[model samples]
Target chain A: SQELEQSPQSLIVQEGKNLTINCTSSKTLYGLYWYKQKYGEGLIFLMMLQKGGEEKSHEKITAKLDEKKQQSSLHITASQPSHAGIYLCGARRNRDDKIIFGKGTRLHILP
Target chain B: SQTIHQWPATLVQPVGSPLSLECTVEGTSNPNLYWYRQAAGRGLQLLFYSVGIGQISSEVPQNLSASRPQDRQFILSSKKLLLSDSGFYLCACSPSGYNEKLFFGSGTQLSVL
Candidate 1:
């Protein structure tokens, strides 16, 4: 079975600081997705990456899929208190396969 | 412009009690529906998925079952709940296509005592 391992399970950063969260897969990924969730709320779609070496950005958040298609990184520039939440990375092995998610990185932005 | 609606933002049930959670998708028809459970420290686990009415695929063997009675309605049920079943339940939907992104519902926090 393929699994995604996220690094830095929890991170606390001061406002205006930059941070990066990583998601690595045990097998090749057909597609990778980034989502954000506020406490006790549903997940909001952030970005999706397909094709090796793909990168996408929305606002101050940027997501990148490595050339190998087995790793991805989400970076936040000039973090804000509003950015405090859980960031989840999900992936699928095939275009029609079920997407599985990582445990998620708990981010806390200090004001 | 698809949206998923899941009911019972929170729930508490005793062991052996029956459980039912409902999910409906609006703004779309014949979408793929899924049920995912997020246990503490256990990421999101795929419980069930359905591609069409009266069709369901179980991802794992558990104390739960899912039904798709209508094109846009998905339901998760259990004959008797267990303590280990306590977790955050999320309902999601995606268009029937390759490499489509999933839209999630607000989710239900289930606590089995």
Candidate 2:
């Protein structure tokens, strides 16, 4: 079984629309990270959430960790063409050095 | 600020050919280094990690091997490449701490024929 699960394997939205991506973990999350990967490129760090019930936002994107610390959600507002890319959620298990990633959500924006 | 450089950005080789991919970190000392491979439509798979010079921990058994010859350098090598080795290879580093955030390199796209 996969340790991490991401919903909506792929998403397509129109420009200026809003969308949300979700990540769920089977175990307790000690650290959660969100990254964006453009086509044929490395991942770009978006946000990191540690504590339960924590939420962080940068620009139009906001990531929140649930109170149970087992799930996270990333919401993007007024999506633009540049927001079209792959969004990946990674989680660290209790005290582990390695991060486990989900299969990623491929997001596309129509201009 | 720390940055990771991985090269060559893309590579192509025939089956049974030798392979070497290099990654180096700058502006950081004693950082934890890692190698990961992503197959098409799959998530990242941890291949190897190093805590310090001459130390390596393999997460899986495969045709590839990793070495840390210097504090900031990590190399991934294969005695004989296989067609299954074609994928996107990424190098990542984290500050020396448990559950730290990883910074990834630009990645190498490998095509084995």
* Number of the top-ranking candidate, with DockQ as the measure: 1
TM-score of each: 0.98, 0.97
> Please, what are the lDDT tens digits per residue for candidate 2 over residues B1-113?
78999999999999999999999999889999999998887787889999999999999889999999999999999999999999999999988776678899999999999
User: What TM-score quantifies how close candidate 1 is to the native fold?
Assistant: 0.98
Worst 10 residues of 2 chain B by lDDT: B94-103
**All DockQ scores:** 0.88, 0.73
Clashes of each: 0, 0
Clashing pairs in 1: none
Tens digits of per-residue lDDT, candidate 1, B1-113, equal: 99888999999999999999999999998899999999898988999999999999999999999999999999999999999999999999999875799999999999999
Clashes of 1: 0
The residue ranges of model 2 lying beyond 4 angstroms of the native Cα positions read: none
Q: Name every residue pair that clashes in candidate 2.
A: none
Full-model lDDT for every candidate: 0.95, 0.92
